[model samples]
Target: MSNIIEKNVDLLKKANVYFDGRVTSRNYTDKDGVVKSLGVMLPGEYTFNTKAPESMEILGGKVEVLILSGLDNNWETYGAGETFEVPGNSSFEIKVLELADYCCTYLS
Candidate 1:
């Protein structure tokens, strides 16, 4: 996928701050009306609950993820250019090995 999204995007000016500012993201909607967020996470561990099915692309840095559902609950590592999916109405634990940049696309 391309790194740049050049047009027809509606971005919110305010950020969605979480974990006491350890994580921050800006919400945006694409031309196709897909809700997405571009965010950065500082080196730390965090748990996030999802309301919608999400596709998380790792833009930079390394992270270990453990999805908190289903029988196969193992920590998987992902780095830049990798992607993972989280089920709707579920949660996951993430350990950011370094400062990480990510983009989250909410699926319908």
Candidate 2:
């Protein structure tokens, strides 16, 4: 069984912009774990790294992303408040062109 844990992030800063939201909760087990988080962003470009053993599922928002993992590098674009899944063991980054709000849950 996995245990649920709550995390909070009122805001995340990148390049003079702020991403605001609370990281609601997360669940973890011996073999796997899941983390849920949310963020709202004003128009800008930002970049971040993804640690291993983590996957991200976008619950909402619109943005463009570039993923570079294991020999596969590509650009992915999302629409308003869309859901998308990103596999673990991949390194990626994101860029936003407009005001956007998103929630993401990570599974491993």
Candidate 3:
């Protein structure tokens, strides 16, 4: 879970706001053409549905995640420098324990 600094990327001006603005993110295309988003999550629970496989990196805070499609079905906690992956066409539940800074990379 190294810190990711994306340079030479194309970013969208509009934000992706969800859960009544408790979560917000900006989508961007990195130099390598990978799609990603940088977002902040206030302490709240959120359910996200994904179209592509996603790698979620915890940048600064803590979160508990339960993958809807995973076999384990147990909630897992992640802190700074940790990451979790979710498969495409699946959904996940995330609980933010504190203000969380995160990066989500969409995988092909």
Candidate 4:
């Protein structure tokens, strides 16, 4: 991923708050027409639903996750500079091991 992004962004206010406000995000579209979002997750367990295939890169801290149809009930850990993918029409449970900062790409 590039180290830079657009300066201006649209905030998703009044919605997209999850885990009782423990997670929050702001989304933006790039010049190439790809959609992405920056999000922060406080220390908590959270579940996220996806409308499209999503790729998330951890920018800070760490997370352990159990994806829908995850292998052998396995839970995977990811940290800064690591990435994970979730298929569209699925859900994943994430345990925030630390204050995690992430950027996600929404892929159609």
Q: Write model 2 residue lDDT over 1-108, tens digit each, in one string.
A: 022333343333332233342223323222334344545655566655555344443434567878766566678887664555655655556776665656555554
lDDT of 1 by residue, 47-101 (tens): 9999999999999999999999999999999999999999999999999998999
- Model 2 TM-score is 0.54
Please state the error at residue 22 of candidate 1 in Å.
Answer: 0.5
Quantify all predictions' global Cα lDDT against the true fold. Answer: 0.94, 0.51, 0.93, 0.85
The top-ranked prediction according to lDDT is: 1
Pairs of residues at least 3 apart in sequence or in different chains that clash in candidate 1:
none
3 or 4: which has the higher TM-score? 3
User: What is the full ranking by lDDT, best candidate first?
Assistant: 1, 3, 4, 2
**Could you tell me which 10 consecutive residues in candidate 3 have the lowest summed lDDT?**
1-10
Off by over 4 Å in 1: none
TM-score on alpha carbons, each prediction: 0.96, 0.54, 0.94, 0.85
TM-score of 1: 0.96
Compare candidates 2 and 4 on lDDT and give the better one: 4
Clashing residue pairs, backbone N/CA/C < 3 A, model 3: none
Sort order, TM-score high to low: 1, 3, 4, 2
Give the per-residue lDDT digits (tens) of candidate 3, residues 1-108.
564567799999999999899999999999889999999999999999999999999998999999999577999999998999999999999999989999999999
C-alpha lDDT (0 to 100) for residue 10 of candidate 4: 55
Collision pairs in model 2: 61-81
Candidate 4 TM-score, true structure as reference:
0.85
